[model samples]
Target: MPGIGPSIAAHLDEIFKTGKSRHFEAVMKGLPKAMFDLMEIPGIGAKRAYRLTKELKIGSVAELEKAVKEGRIAKLEGFGEESQAEILKSIEDTKAKSKEKRHLLPYAEDIAHEIIEWMKREKLVARVDPLGSLRRKASTVGDIDLSAATKNPAKVIEHFTKYPNKKRVLEKGTRTASITLPSGVQVDLMVETPDAYGALLQHFTGSKHHNIALRNYALKKGLSLSDYGIKKKGTEDYLKFKDEESFYRFIGMDYIPPELREDTGEIEAAIDHKLPKLVELEDIKADLQIHSSFDIETSHDLGESSMEEIIQKASNLGYEYIAFTEHNPSRSKHNDQQIIDILKRKREVVDKINYELQNRSAHLRETSARHSEKIDQINYSLINMNKKNIQKARPQATGALATVGRVFNSLEIDIMPDGRLPVPEDGMKTLDFALISIHGSFRLSKDKMTERVLKAFDHPKVKIFAHPTGRKLGHREGVELDWPKIFDFCKKNNKWLEINADPMRLDLPDVLVREAVKLGVKLTLGTDSHHKDSMENMNYGVSVARRGWAGKDNIVNTRSLVEFLELLKG
Candidate 1:
């Protein structure tokens, strides 16, 4: 404060008043606005935008597009043919995305989770529930809303105002608070008493239409609903609940999951006791698509663990099986024969590990039997002597041995532009399964893309489709295709589709997943993991499946190894 100047003090005051920095605008006045606008293009960073405007005299995207089309951008010092083409593609992608609404699902979920966790750590908070579209697991969220049950509302409000990531506090009060995060997304919090917390959560965690429908139903039952509680038609006495299950049951219906409370016949289904038992995270028994260090070379295909490490981790998670679907070597820097040989060796290694695990399990069984016999003899001696001071012999515990989970050798093969398999038939035969995927050429026409995918499905060896849509969140749009036809084809062909669990690519998204389930097509959940720790992303895929209303019966990986193998045989 000693060195504080009038200009700096004025800047700070302006920011506090207007929630924006006036000084930044004053500084940017020296540069052309077009230079800043050009920075919005995907591949054009600040430096590149400045260079384009200063050196090439290109101040607009249209002019940059013209330059790219005329081969002029390729002539620039730092730009090459590939960079120019990519820039053009980025321009097109930006234009396309501008017309779409909603932020990516994962981005919004992360921000909400961070805030909820921070709130839960406060001693005064009894419970914190993320509400609204986020709770429903929508593919994109408009804003974040959270409800908390706490008797000390004043303390909760103070804690929220002091959140480390807060850019600015919009409003603060004893019962409600609002703040804007650094990411420019606004978050609202409501604090209520424990007696009315369930009703408060239900009222706020709703689609507007769903809430309206529920209110109408309540009116018909001579009841009134509010955030605080439910009341009779002519009385102020509120019937409160501590949990959603009791709240729904009091209304003469089974509890509805947040994901299914979209006013899409779920209310009727609940009343009739016919709601599907939705798939849960614990229902998943395997990760059918994963990558490890055994895969071939690629800048983006870097893996942090070996096949054995992956198996151990999967086993620790109580999985009965896992598949090592490494990127096909044809896309890597390896020759076909070399890649095939490498896969064969990896298969042998996995088989040997499985054999050792089987032997260890057998040994444990034998050891347990001998221990039981000794304990029985000691008990008989104690009984015969009628001794009260007999010492009990304890059975020795087994050490931390790896679980006997089977590891299958598989490949994430590319679906060629013309819809043929990238790997040869002989190479495919050596693998346990083939995960077909479309890595590039995403701008193909809808009919062409659909036909291309259909042709790939025609291959007898291709058992599963990975990240079927090929969409990268906040970046690229997936190729267009007739999804119903694709779903029908998968159902008829006895093939499976993947719920790719990469945070950026939760493809075969919720809506498509629902359609696939209705068509009776089996689904597999894969983390599409590249690193050892990434296998944990299986939860995200499960969330997507739940949002789609998928049940355990619809997922292939939920089956045991023997059941899964039988399904694969079809």
Candidate 2:
């Protein structure tokens, strides 16, 4: 946003509004999708990638590497053997660097899904599961690992080799196999009998430190651990477990959740039966951050879907409520009075929609009760026989207490450089609550940033701090802040922190979430969704919460409307 000029902004606005821009079309005239990926290679620019792809049909780095090895690039115009050698060096450098980097959790999950779903179709495979950091739901993962349960290990291995998206089969054996995806990420698979599957999963799923700690704990009991099973120190015989619960039970501990298997004192907690009931996706009842197409003339991007459309999507997801926390009206363009007027207008619209949803749900419930009563009065025996059908005849309501669409007219207002909120007191009062965030001046010293955030929290309506760390997973680091002080302030002042569910910013990262949970701080989950469909990202937030060992009690969004309003009052 800082580097963008007026012309660039105009171009973007045009594309957003109409999906077409003459200048953009001219710039992208003859390029194929592959050229974009090719440009990502270390030394290749757009012009070079375009020429190479068009001239030699080298659509990927792998293909380009092949051409370079074949001496084909040296023969091309303006490229001699020396230039070819330089390109080869760059390619090698890139390959080595990529291998050291980890893929994002969603990307790894998708790759695992392809493998597990494919293996499930094999007749010999009874159960398949992901293993390693993937099972722990880490933010990023290295190469994928999975395991399958089957008596016919050889057949399962054979079936794995025939996977459709596999670029190459690295290895194949009677009980194991490995493959490389076309994307160059490797996938490893293991096969085990049903009786031994639990041992395999537990062995592979825990982190290296977790495994060592668990093994050492078992060694104290004169037991040795292995993928096959646990065995006595002096005995060759191994005792098999049919499931993970049994595996942990035999070791005299409760089953440690996969997310908590990070050697983070989880083993000790499990032994004492003190492990928290980790939060699940089902515990989520609201998506606190949403943007609807109710325009208030903000400088930032507007929502692409209407509030009605978002409510309908939330209904399908079974949410009790959602907050439309759009960016506050552009400060430069609107007067204080204008901003207040716009916010008041938006609140009225939310109230009108809530009225309709409440009335509709009530009418349906009343009608359902009447129908059930008539069925009973008509014939007692028939009513007994058709009770389930009578309940089915009634339309199902989306909310927990016979209501839905309890919209929160919230604003994601920016925390100004000097620690002031952009919105005036009157405009702020219109919001059910305000969520403050720092969008710029990320270079502030730790004390300044801390003071800046604390000043924003002084406002009574500012109930949550959105994307507190402001980190973009692979692109940029977050601003400097005194997190201990920040967490302490929130805990004492009854302010909530946000876990932004956007893939780019799972902010208030897992480590911080864990700290917040430990310090008695409450956190909320929001998709930061610009469109209705992005609401589904709430699951990723729940994943972060669970990884932090948060229970349902720690997440504010898990609260119903009544309970959430009570917190706001406090």
Best lDDT among the predictions, by candidate number: 2
* lDDT (C-alpha, whole model) for all candidates: 0.82, 0.87
- Please provide, for model 2 over 144-235, each residue's C-alpha lDDT reduced to its tens digit, 9 standing for 90 to 100: 99999999999899999899997656567787887767787878899899988999999999788999999999999999999999998899
Give the worst 10-residue stretch by lDDT in candidate 2. Answer: 391-400
* Cα lDDT of model 1 by residue, 468-546, tens digit: 9999887888889988889888988998999998878888888888888878989999999987788888888988898
TM-score for candidate 2, please give it: 0.81
lDDT of 1 at 559: 96
TM, every model: 0.76, 0.81
- Model 1 TM-score, all chains together: 0.76
In TM-score terms, which candidate is top? 2
Residue-pair clash count for candidate 2: 0
Superposed model 1: Cα runs more than 4 Å off? 1-110, 298-300, 331-335, 368-404
